[model samples]
Target: MCDGYATHNGELAIGRNLKVAFMPWKGYNFEDAIILSERVVREDLFTSLHIAEHVVSVRETKRGSEELTADIPNISENATKDLDENGMIRVGAHAKTGDILIGKITPKGESDPTPEEKLLRAILEKAGDVKDASLKQNHLTKVL
Candidate 1:
């Protein structure tokens, strides 16, 4: 299981699945992370560009409500239907297979991978899509 923690800019931005691990983790002194992240990308800290991954939500919101409401602070509010009760919005889904990629971002980069990584990537490319989760994971492992 992932720890759901990633740091960014040395401060903490905690939230569900929003791993507070990269930089700017809650109240952390980013004084070091910023310098290092900058150097890493500029100096090729890992053989190539470092890629960080995260999920993006695809949510649904109604244009208007038929009959529902929530209190607004110092503002005029009218009837509104609760999104949770009607939202049911889902990210890209594969019909029949029920498989989905939800969201992903792969950095545009290339590296002189070790023979093993090269082999792994080739194998993964030949066998994938969201349907083969393992392959996708393995491919990412290689890239990272």
Candidate 2:
């Protein structure tokens, strides 16, 4: 029954954890989220909760399986672009899976864009897809 999923409150990024304790949609109150979660739990329909932050996504699955017969699979953001003290945009995947990241966005005017922007640019510059842009280490960390 969970057909269309969108941001709870804050602007959705790329890979945020939906099950995060501090979800973006707090305005609606934890009660709302909890209520929905409770219903789903009792029904045993959507076996898991997920999130798509501007960086990572938290989802549920067996070991190596796609298509959520219970839901959907092969699931997959925005932050901003910015430079660090060393003037480097740290970006990557922070999922619990073994995904890969590949790309590098040329720095812009230098206001220090958010992680989302940096990652987007990197993707464009290298002409890559979201599935491939995995920053294994550094600023971006894959939770898995």
Candidate 3:
């Protein structure tokens, strides 16, 4: 009967069954309190792995369109070490907090230009109106 019930319910064992002792230690385990061994936590016996997906989208704006590139201005080389040539994170890379996952740039409106910028714009004949829009990691995680 038990076998039939388990088969019908699709139930399976999920944890280890350990031998427990009901003993009082400094009056802490007098009631329904339970104490766990340090080895259980050190070995991560109860830890579970959770997988999540994040996405980045590029769309057209009123000024210009968004672009993805690895050559983002004002960012250090160490911050973009995990990114590939396509501005995306490399597969199986270990990412930590504040790491850039994707390097993006968006166009911005033109304000008052400085003397150097005006000279460069006049020589190059191109207006610099873009700002960094990179995606950064919120927590320490591994990219898979």
Q: What would the per-residue lDDT of candidate 2 be over residues 18-46, giving only the tens digit for each residue?
A: 35244447577555433345655677765
Model 2: lDDT of residue 71: 12
lDDT of 3 by residue, 11-80 (tens): 7645676655566666674555456788887998878787988788999876557888787878988888
lDDT of 3 at 43: 95
Q: Candidate 2 regions off by >4 Å?
A: 1-42, 56-96, 105-133, 136-144
In angstroms, the error of model 1 at 103 is: 26
lDDT of 1 at 137: 23
lDDT of 1 by residue, 1-144 (tens): 233256456656553331223466577766434334455557764564555473443322221112211222222222112112322213322122221212121212234355675477678853111111110122222221
| TM-scores for every candidate against the unseen true structure | 0.14, 0.16, 0.61
* Model 3 worst lDDT run, 10 consecutive residues: 1-10
Using TM-score as the measure, the top candidate is: 3
Per-model RMSD to reference = 25.9, 20.9, 6.3
List clash counts for every candidate, in order.
22, 35, 0
User: What is the descending lDDT order?
Assistant: 3, 2, 1
Candidate 1, after superposition: displacement of residue 32 in Å? 12
